[model samples]
Target chain A: MKETWKELPIGCIIEEGGTSRKFKTGDWRSERAIFSKEKCTNCLLCYIYCPDDSIIMKNDKVVGIDYDFCKGCGICAKICKAKAIEMKPER
Target chain B: MPMKALTGNEAMAEAMRQINPDVVAAYPITPATEVVQLFANFVADGRVDTEFVAVESEHSALSACIGAAAAGGRVMTSTSSQGLALMHEMLYIAAALRLPIVICGINRSLSAPINIHCDHSDTMGSRESGWMHIFAEESQEAYDSIFQAIKIAERAYLPMIVSTDGFIISHCMQRIDMLEDKEVQDFIGECKPHHSLLLTDKPYTVGPLSLQDYYFEHKRQEIEAMMQVAPIIDEVGKEFGDKFGRHYGLFEEYKLDDADNIIMAAGSAAGTAKVAVDEARDKGIKAGLLRIRVMRPFPYKQIQKVLKDKMIISVLDRSDSMSTMGGPLFIETRAALYDTETHPPICDYIYGLGGREIDVENILSVFEKGEIYKKKGVEKKLAFIGVRE
Candidate 1:
């Protein structure tokens, strides 16, 4: 039955591009939110809700997101009043 | 237990609240702005804990939703007319990524002449974007299809569009019995992500352009996933009926079992046809109505089953195909029945363009004209309703 089910015409929509698969089960969360220096405020919302304390600041200005520990919840971007934080797929 | 008063826009918001989507990114547009506003109010009042992102433009609204869903969150967003046009690029990308996002597309006439009433032009233009399309007849179906869309899309890993006629359902208020919060949550909760971003350690890339060698395979896989959705939708619909006592199918038949003639339509026109069908039944005309809810994944099999022995099938599309031989939904319905051995004579009627009122008399006229073609045994011609040119 599964064989006939495979041959059944489910229409043409099912054939669209979806071959790109994620490498690791949790790799998407490891990437830390990065702030473009030309575009960030020292609001510290990222620091407060990194959920892992993955954000740190220095000299009264924004510093960096700790990729080693930052789970990319994107709450930082949601809470950013300046929209300074950007979540990028980690290398 | 049976009915509660709500507008189509309000029901859309209510459905979002019941599903408890993780995020809702929305911008306001005519006829559909109220849906977003209702959802925003639900978020503000703490009724739904979704992160309601009030974006600046429709593009950003849909982009933000794509970002959230790619991060493995159950996301929802909605727009209509120009807003839908603005998000055109993102709509295709969302479907390509298999984001499992659902959108409430309050259908409206597209611009240029700038009409704010009901039509399917906006939805029709996006028909090939790889999103499952579900049409709702009234506020209750609008409410129910929302829940069903999430389940189907998540399981199939495809996006869905739940559409309703703009002013017809969006502005009118009606009483609908809403599924209890606990019940709705249980039914839709099966869509819980297999490996969402909340859990750290897995890495995935979504929506990357591939070379010619790999492009076909990627598209093939998406089709496989979409094919899997047909059975899932059926199973979920049955399960929902068992739990909530409200039953819906891909094609909803009203008084069609013993009828030889049927008027087929979608969205609110199907509701309008129901009233007319009731009147026709009283006169012993054996007239009935077939309302299609789930338009994509086309429900070809279910349509074949319901329309087995009918003598004539009249399909009414609320939007024209412009210069095409038939209307958009009409083309699809005809295609579905074309290969079947037991299908009936089909007629295509294009009506209610740009929100012209479809009164009972108009419904009767369409049916009678279709019957005239049936009696003469000639192919039906494309029609225009209230079209004075």
Candidate 2:
């Protein structure tokens, strides 16, 4: 982020796409999602519902959660029908 | 150049035809309808390559202009009174987005009984909307201002409003010296926009949500751009004068040199005031007139330099501020003179509301009052001319 007016873009226009990725929002989370691959139904429900696109997928199968971008909103845990995803307090 | 008798609306339309802008999205309203009506006729006849959008309402009209302008299209629009009032929110949006959209606001009084006439209430109400404003005194100036506005707006990367009194200038016909289409085209050149939405290689968002963290900084940038416009106006005006022979400035000083008493005004009222100034000069009252052509980026230093030595100054405002402090012009003029060393006793006169006629006699009385104020100091801070008690 530009600290001064001289360095700021004209009209504060954002020039680049996905600029939100620069700010690590995952640090804002107090809770983390734990994904169990063995118990998962591979429905990709968590992948589809992750607001931050934090759900990691490989070959259309839910693998894990990318904690770098997640704010731990817990929507994945709430939507998991097979009780595969669990929200855990950060240690 | 060719001289032709044209109404203010026709003059503005002819200017638009000559400039040949990319888009003109406007809705119809009283007093301002003919401007767009005539331009639409030009579009239909294939005289100009303008995409004329006859939107459903004034709100949509401005909204479409915003969209088109953001896409790097040179746009123009016209409206008056309620039409302008409806586009109020979008007015700020257009400026904040920094699109070089040129608008011709036919000034009219606001509602209560809903009157359509010549008044500055519409433009005055939008004084703080972050758009550069220029007022036209007659059809000739109205025609000339359109080209100047295009150059100024594009250069500053800001929106501009070229206003003329509704009905008084919009509907009345006057002889106007028009520039040839090629001359206007070459003078204005092409609309070169900065940070357009249509640039595929460099994708960017416009009018984005800027929270508290960055909104202030964005506003600061806008302020800087607006400040730069004052000098740009003079530069463009000088260049236009060099090529076209008719010069423009922040304000016109009519026999202001060596004058003790002067009346500062804008729009067509200045024309009436000039006649009064001449009448006062004949009687050796040492009276003069200062006609403010550019309102926004208000010529603070220029006004101070012109009126600093004067003994008495009367600011004529066509619309009342309703704050009991006269009107916008009066308030601005007072504020501009606040820091001056002389601090001349300035009075404000509110007149010509709702199409009220202001003849030479009415303006002459104000000049006479200025003479009295120079001798006796100011008796009243605010007074209404040609108004019943």
Candidate 3:
């Protein structure tokens, strides 16, 4: 059962900060970004340009996309001069 | 208590001096300018330790107030007419956030032809904005009600608008007994807030984007809080009365019992109605007045009980809804009496728009018409008192 209004905090105030991680905004995306490793130079442009900051990095090198926070805005793909990030239908 | 001669605006500022909130963010407007201006002086002179922010506009004023209140500070502000209309968006946010910010709301006419005068249009237009309303008839009520408003708003965690008529009360001087600063401070104890943005150990997020999934539940909390404010208002009013010797209730009923004719009104017009009722009574006419002090958690059940079996009833409104039905007070009063056994002819009157002159004789004319209707209740009619039509 869902929590009632009384069970929730007063004044629409959520009692915690940094809750976006748990809420995960990527579910509403109509498109998803796929990392193309062969064409990628790992220049870190996509990492810096991801609108949702969903670009995954291991040791300062881009490894993949964290799809949880990405809403597929295509910002990372557009900003990637290497054409390493591609947007496709989420199916 | 020593009596001090003060205008409605001065009375409000004096109350602010006594409460001395942590923050006051406001933009000045007609009739209400003196309230903030006076408080700014108090801050300048170092009499009170309040952070007075001279905001650019009414919207910014209320936004600053919301920010301060969410940060665990007692906040206040004052505005009128277009200023209030400008702050409409933040009014919903402040109430939705449950910030107990008290406002010295000077009632004035909204601009169409750009008129600056006494009218209920400003506050009445904001009736549905999730704030408590307290209408004052004169300077004394304006002074006394602010102290009670602070307690009530803080207790219920809702915003409050304690309003006085534009120039009618805000400019005119009246003698009102005042409690000393210590007495006033004792009446309203130290401000203890439950939550704050600065409390880093336990963090919180305010004004989050709540969509269809949980927006309905948040609104349900507001609905219950609004309903819960009625008893809090009553208890606070009685406590203020006991401490300050000025008893208050949800509404003031003057000579309601054993009377056949009743005139219902609020704000400054209610004072004129009282004099008219007395004159009518002197001439063997059984006329009474129901002065509604609190308009928000509208005392519907109490009003219904007081108005039962009355033969002639007329509801006076200072502002028109332009709906052709009636003004705000007239609409609510009619609804309150809907299920009562006695179906009294509740006439509707819109008067004093844009500070139009209305006195005892003009009000007596309405009562005299009530005398004729008292013989046998007639069809309910909508009429304008001072407007040339």
Candidate 4:
């Protein structure tokens, strides 16, 4: 037996991207693949080729995603020749 | 604390009894039938309030559990090789629907050449079916993991698959410390459905066929949920360890502190690897064992961290990736450690496949051969342990 930390369920996490509401309701089912900038080739294949249109543009480079809308099909990783894209499980 | 001398199957039933699930659905199959049989006895004796549903097939077993879980009921099931294969369809559905049902899979060889013995192929075959897979090295884990599964599954709302080596852990008698029923009941608590059928008064569909418009989104959500489960499992395992004094994590490390060689394995093979590691250590060889407890979430960070300093890592897989370059687990483990800066050279050995016995001798021999193979680098074929062909 060890110390019991305050266990928070997936649904209870605070949401992001809100000016009015700080702690937004989290979606346990939504996941997005975060790309490692150091490893990325900037091929834009993940950008021009996204099936769900979840991949977005940022600073003239392919970046950012709406995981709530993005289905983790792993298409970007499959197409990334550099293997820069890694699917991170999101809550 | 009343101690019980029980087999793995009996302990599993005791865990179920402690959890006091709403439904217990399973089909009779070799090495696994005893699990459900003991559960049925628990139900008969009125020791636990559960619905013991004897289904006609493994498919029905999982299907019924799926329905029970979706309908806001805590459900559990158990089966083996062919039976797991039989429930393949429902396994996908259970995860897709985000039902928190947990099933016990007695790891056995998939039938083709036809032998009813222990192997990972049975459970390995379902590694990607969107279920959280946890393998037990012995009866303690077999009993304890099931209790943790309900909490883990429900928290993430993802189906959980808990497995152990067939006959080895299932039939072998072990002195297991049964968790107090009140403790288990309190730990598991009540099932809080994210999308319960009983809440039909609100009128929300549970599993609607998503067309091209929404099917992809449904799948994406499922993947996200699975990813969340990794940390949740870690957190819950820590809590359970606090409650029950057993810490079950992504993997258990043995003698890796100074070892240059590490062996990657799952299920009961981890125990065998420990024996070999001890032998090798006694012989002044820096060999260690990494027993994978959680497979689906594939503890990449842990593997990368533990194996980063090792000179060579030998991944022993009980199931072959089958025509792939290396074993399936090897592929996953390599991928998990891919981006890491301090990762070691990893190779794979496919042994104990098809229910073949992997004893202490087999493990030691594998370690010896693994060192030799490590010098040569990744091989085109996996070395077969205890196999003569």
Question: Which number leads on TM-score?
Answer: 3
Docking quality (DockQ) for each candidate:
0.03, 0.46, 0.77, 0.01
Worst 10 residues of 3 chain B by lDDT: B372-381
Stretches of model 4 off by over 4 angstroms after superposition: A1-91, B373-381
Arrange candidates by TM-score, descending.
3, 2, 4, 1
Worst 10 residues of 4 chain A by lDDT: A8-17
**Residue B214 alpha-carbon offset, candidate 3, angstroms:** 1.5
Residue B287 lDDT in model 3?
93
Give the per-residue lDDT of model 3 (tens digit) for B25-45: 999899899999999999999
By lDDT, the best candidate is: 3
- Residue B249 of candidate 4: its Cα lDDT? 81
Q: Among these predicted structures, which one has the highest DockQ? A: 3
* Candidate 1 vs 2: which has more DockQ: 2
- In angstroms, the error of model 3 at B87 is 1.0
Q: What are the clashing pairs of model 3?
A: none
Which regions of candidate 2 fall more than 4 Å away from where they truly are?
Answer: A1-3, A18-40, A45-55, A64-91
Better of 1 and 3 by lDDT: 3
Candidate 3 Cα misplacement greater than 4 A, ranges: none
Clash totals for all candidate models: 20, 0, 0, 2
Model 4 chain B — which ten-residue stretch has the worst lDDT? B202-211
**What lDDT does the true structure give each of the candidates?**
0.79, 0.90, 0.91, 0.80
